[model samples]
Target chain A: MRAVALGDQTTYDAGTLTVSSAEAAALVADPALAEVRVSWASPGDSTRIVKVLDAVEPRTKGPGGGGIFPGFVGPAMPQGRGTTHVLRGTAVVTAGFLPRAQEAVVDMSGPAAPLSPLGTTHNLVVEFAPAPGAAWEAVYEALRNGSLALAARLAEAALGATPDAVEELPGLPDAGDRSLPRVAAITNLQTQGTFKEIFVYGRSFGSIALPTLIDPGDLDDGAVVSGQLGHPSLKNPTWVFQNHPVVAALRARHGVDLLCAGVVLSPEPVDATNKELVSAHAARLCKAAGFDAVIVTKEGGGNADADMALKMDALEELGIPTVALYAEMAGADGTGPSIVVPPTKATAMVSTGNYDERLSLPAMERALGGDRVDVAAATALDAFELPAAVVYASLSPLGWGHLTCQEAS
Target chain B: MTTRVVHYINQFFAGLGGEDTATVPPASKAGAAGPGRKLAQLLGDDFEIVATVWCGDDHAAGPEVMDDLLALVRAAGPDVVVTGPAFTSGRYGLACARVAAAAAAEGIAAVACMHPDNPGIDEAGTAPVVASGEVARQMGPSLETLAAAVRKVAAGEPLGADDGRVGKIPRRNVTVDRTSAERAVALVLARLGGDREATEVPLPRFDQVTPAQPVTDVTTALVALVTEGALVPDANPDSLESARATRWLRYSLDGRDVLPAGEFRSVHGGFSTVWANEDPHRIVPLDAARQLEAEGAIGKLHGEYLVTAGNGTSVGNARRFGVEWAADLRRQGVQAALLTAT
Candidate 1:
């Protein structure tokens, strides 16, 4: 896979990634919208930015009309294969007051910098001002789509230039060494109900859903996108969807330690019977696929921990050694029980980190300005004290991050 | 300034007559006495043994023991409480654990050492207990462990995981910094290599509480409805958040037959509240409870309902809510409660 790894102070026309305040105002200049604002942001900015809805990396499918994140932004197409051009690092971040309950903030510098990529990467910030009459659903759609369109436009600059790197992920072997352990990963998506959601191949999941297989290739090509915005410290961002860490981690040791049998795109069911039904089917899939072991990961929030615990129990009962991964929502102090319904069976559990730990961040020198800044009202304190739950700036817990431990002292 | 310490021990360790003197009552001494001298010597210049409290095992286990001991320790005003390195003596071990618990309740740093097989080990709860051997011969090493535990607890140093130079009872609910993916890989590799790594989340130990006796006659019993389903007044007067609720709303239902559709709604973020919002009774069920009251299936309905969003609600907050509300219901003479979950 070829991707253009862009750097800090990354450029569009030999200058910094640029967009006019006037052009930004007009781009979101819907009659329904009160106002819109945009600006270019570089790493180590003086101030912080808040109310981030989503961030999209600029790229035009390695040199074709078919864009990244097909179905939502462009026409549907199979990803992972072929040359996809890249303007890798920098992204267009959407800032807005979402129609639903909450959103996230990204600190560009200070002690909070290490928590999110938003701290390191240069950003083109687009802040939205919702009008009195503007519908929330319309606002959500406009900000998301607007970010993608900006990404494609930026990719036009890197079209004729050569890519910085090429990554190779070989397809599964028709026949592998008999001793290799077949491993399947179950991405436990939190699409069971309500506001938070995840999209698999452009379709939103809810209710009694079954597991679907996702190719490693498709995963690298934006097969999964997170629609859920709450619980930001641990949520998977669109960038992680394009370059999945689990897929990358597994593919690294694919041939030697274990064979990447396949990925199971599993959605959590809200009720008990549905959870049982779906998990039981997943156990069957493990057996039919001849998987020697499986890794289970969950998208953050709710009682999805129960869904993961039930799924692990099912697989373990089948004599399959399973690994369960999640960000522990153990509340703000880390003294509470780590999970809602913990598994009784002897299963290997991995915590991504506590979503509730607090941090005190120093004020930044510059702020990536936004319109109608009610995001300020979101916090009551003047000091930058926040829970670990708010810093998805790095898209951790669900992706590449520290391995948190729950030490009983 | 020196850290003041109070050491507690039993009659035998106090150099009082053994077994025959077991019925003697408790006594408070001015400074390091008997084994307290050894612990005080080991604790170094930073810690000064201000008082030593000794008692017969039977006397310390009696009803007034904890109060008497607390009063003695309060006057001594010690920075830390070091109870017996109670070896194999079950009665002494139990006494020491109890004294340590009392000290902890008074917000004093405390440590208790006992043999693993002693009955006190399990009952010590979150009190740091240094594992001691079953014989008095182990007192030297046991005191060293006890001193270290006291110092660590006093200094507030993290003691679980590989920081094992000082080990305490495992509290599996504390979270540290590590991502789940890395943990998964390590665990997977360990499994494949036929090895075991400690789980990030140890299998949770659940407490089993006895259920309350059921109300034999609903026609005469007063019933109240409580829910973590996040039912709130239309305006959300308390402004309880959609998730991670720390506060609950108590809505008055004294004269109401039904919760009007727009007057009540599910403010929860976890599930679709459309159906619950369409008919508020689907969650809190005021209409149904009223119907039961009218039909004489229940005596009287509590005039108010309590609600909070349970999704990702912290165990601490939930516990506080349960305790505070249970008292409120009991004060109102409610005989039974119906808890609804979303």
Candidate 2:
């Protein structure tokens, strides 16, 4: 990769595309590509590049026009010739493309002037893309195929991702089954120093009536859809995975014992009232669904007191224990209020993503494998060997050509 | 002789108004004020409705409210003070618990009741009596429990085990078995209770802590000011974990002479929305490595600054990260670290 960039041309070697500085300079010399920037993606991957450009025309309003005008008329009738000077910069180029394996191509090549301070912001972006026949092929192929069945089977056999494996056991009958003790689940709800108890039921498990105060329609709408499982919502509109399901399922299925919930809060205040309302509604719904507690999953959005207060009020009112699930929001000793409290009745289960139902079965199975997982587990899983191989399989149509039956096996 | 009792009710129950009226302090009114009438009927002739006091829950929870409540209790001159059987209501339970505890402290027998789900059960449990079961409509059985409680108080009987009806502490009796000679000696000792000098009890002493000396040189000294302030990134990088357990990234100063204050911004993992201008001199290290280098604190900034969102990072993780980061910095010939704990 380094050699190609230094060689004054694009070259694909070991699944990496390298562009020479001379090529980049030449591309920038072109008028049409003047504002473009240079970026790269390894073979068989899509990479988005964004460059802010200076000196651009600004749109103006016509006299007596209350709204946007339809088309461009000859330079406005010069009454006073109002000249607008652009500061900052404009984002001119936003493009992405997937390259073929072992194929070296310049994903993005252009020129952009320097801005104040950083001395002409020139950055070479290189994104890693999977190569054909890599180990991650299985996982990538499964997703590309949208083969829920194949995914389910592979997940069940290879990773133990099964419905029975994910369902929490305490919600099941007391059959003195030894597996009962191992069943655990964690939600990503942020509960403040409160206790949370959750009861998971199977599809066959009779429906329990939610409190009348909570509407049933909301729950139905919030329920995890196919392909988007394991995602729970504090706010119905913007759904994410929960933390407790992972912990709960682990305890319920793999004999690894622990129960926890995840909480997600915007680090900043969100203006979406619907999100807030749904969050408030979901807290009540989850409680009515027999959750012992709720925790807020901390997503690094901005935080608003109104949003936090609303969620807190709902959980406190429901008599549910609330704690913040600590992942990567802020350190416990960091500046402000923590999502989770120590010695809190709330426990923490480290996982990837908010506790969404869509990821529940797979995540639970992952937890069951008894791997030492951390906050970076999701990123590591995304870089899993099988996923790389699957990506290679899907991109075979681009140039690498499909693997033969014998090769696939 | 019937035991005289005074009942306390909030302004809403007193029919004064809603939450707005709750701000008013306690005022004693003659016979059967609002809910007091219903309570009177439930108590029957065994209890006399002496006076009823009306106050807001906030007033009851406030210190000033206690003064007025104490005055009302004195004026009512009742043998017992009985407050609500507040069902799942939070403020109501808090008010009842406060008044009941105050009455007990004044040597007046007090009793309060609430439903099992009431939040006050935990807070009010330390008081003289707290009866909990169902709602007010189940007052017949509740009244019997209250009556039994009053009888025990009047007869000077030790309060027994509580079934969550009255009082926070459960009743328990301690029985001491002794031989005849020991019993005689015990009886004589009891008779001479005040005169006997018991064994001296030792009190535990805490070790004194010395104050830490102030840093002499700002340039050389590595000052770490740990704050529970919110230092989240503009884009909350970790959206999956607790707000407390965020990852800390090592910031580099990028060969700059002076650190730019504006570069240091906080994400929202705090109680307040606004960033704290804690100290004018305190600089947030957006590019920490460079700043340290400029200050001559370290030889060279090394490695990618370990980055973790701190929103919901746990104390355990924070400590671990701090130790790990410190260790890594040490390996890179870095000396003197300034850890800004948000």
Q: Which has the greatest lDDT?
A: 1
Q: Taking the tens digit of each residue's C-alpha lDDT, what string does model 1 give over B236-287?
A: 7878777667677788988999998999888886666889999999998888
The CA root-mean-square deviation of candidate 2, after full C-alpha superposition on the true structure, stands at 29.1
Candidate 1 error regions (>4 Å)? A1-16, A19-34, A175-179, A365-381, A393-395, A406-409, B1-107, B110-180, B196-198, B234-239, B247-251, B255-258, B261-266, B274-279
Measured by TM-score, how close is model 1 to the native structure? Answer: 0.76
Instruction: Give per-residue lDDT, candidate 1, residue A154.
Output: 70
Per-model B-chain TM-score: 0.54, 0.47
Candidate DockQ values, in order, are 0.27, 0.02
What does candidate 2's lDDT look like per residue over A1-409, in tens digits? 1211335554434323344545443423322222223342222122212111110111112333211111111221211122211111111111212111110111111110010111111223311223445443232222212211111111112121112122222223233444322111112222121011111111111112221221111111111111110111112111111112222222222333222222122221234464456446656665645544443333222232234335545665675543332211121111111222222122222211111111110112111111322222442112221111111111111011111110000
Fnat by candidate, in order: 0.43, 0.04
lDDT for each residue of candidate 1 in A1-409, tens digit (9 for 90 to 100): 1222234333355333444556445554665567776776666666576667777766667555675677665566667677665566677787656655354667766666656766666777887777787777667666666666666667666666656677778676444445778777887777744347777666776556788776777766666766777666656677665666666677777887888777887877777888888888888888777877888877667467777888888988897888887666555645455666787675578776666666676655555533323323333213466666666534364556653644543
Deviation (Å) of B81 in candidate 2: 1.1
Q: Indicate the worst ten consecutive residues by lDDT in candidate 1 chain B.
A: B161-170
Clashes of each: 21, 147
Docking verdict class for candidate 1: acceptable
Scored by lDDT, model 1 comes in at 0.69
User: What class would a CAPRI assessor give candidate 2's docking?
Assistant: incorrect
Off by over 4 Å in 2: A1-409, B132-144, B156-163, B166-342
